[model samples]
Target: MDEQQGRARRPGGRSARVRAAVHQAVTELVRERGYGNFAVGDIAARAGVADTSLYRRWGNLQALLSDVLLTRLNAQSPMPDTGSLAGDLRTHAANVAREVTGPDGLALVRLTLALSGEGQQGLQARDELLADRTRQLQAMLDRARGRGEDPPDVLEVLDHLLAPIYMRVLFGAGPLTPDYLDGLVDRLLA
Candidate 1:
């Protein structure tokens, strides 16, 4: 909802205030301290809301963090549609590379990997966070197919295209330069 619509519905409701405060605090904390060492109490203090409020809203730190991560991801870079498969793929890969190379993004990835291996909840959260990007790529591929251009398997294309970008970010192999992104697009299109 837009800001006016949100305000009209609640008009300074306590629940809305608490939710907004918690979200803001979580985002700030993640950007500052990384997700590896965040505590509920710290978030509550930062938000100036009771710990119970957060617990009631999110159930646990993991769930709250997952929501926050997904929100930020969606806001930072929306997947673009450039009309051409090569253009669209390059744009998508470049956006991913930019995020993965950032400090906040690296922390999010580490937290996601660690949590996702623990149980079904974590895995579900990970899948939810990735669903938008997955759909975006799939739509781009579908558009290409409709235009009589046969691309490789969508998942294979994503994995092959994103592998080097992740490697460079996760392993500190090299910088995520335009040249690297261009090379990835060329290889994928070939």
Candidate 2:
């Protein structure tokens, strides 16, 4: 067996086992120790991997954590298409809410925000994350246009529907409920 397979066999060959362990260790370290306070050696020790292995795979803590955020958390949230703007948007908002309020999502947002304070590179990564979602939403808007149901400025409508959910998540000030999502859809469709 290869090294990754050997590691996986210990826990029923789940690929996530090792990745999850590493992600958890890095997340906890960042929360308890702060980003700048830890090094690659420290992360490797916490993750129970050799420093060389960690470096060879992820290159840096930021990239590793970003992978964890994207793969484990964000990737699990389903984006729905419901044949109408209101239906689709409500579904999307609900999915976003579910992810943003979860423990992993909060940790990811915290890490991303902390990393973003470092300068251009961090900001670029943060933007890239958001850009991916924006592109997805834009595609949905395009689909709506092709069906002749979209407004003139579909992008703006999508932003208006989604921005509040993001604000609530970032500020930790409000719940993202189905009612709220429905209201957002109503406003956007109105």
RMSD of each: 4.0, 4.8
lDDT of 1 by residue, 97-173 (tens): 87887766675566678567758767776776677667766877889889888766677765787777777788888
Model 2 residue 90 CA deviation (Å) reads 0.3
Candidate 1 wrong stretches, greater than 4 Å: 1-19, 31-33
TM-score of each: 0.78, 0.72
Write model 2 residue lDDT over 12-87, tens digit each, in one string.
4445565667877877887788666787788778878788877666656666666656655546665567887667
Q: What clash pairs does model 1 have?
A: none
For TM-score, the strongest prediction is 1
Worst lDDT 10-window in candidate 2: 5-14
Relative to the true structure, candidate 1 has a C-alpha RMSD (angstroms) of: 4.0
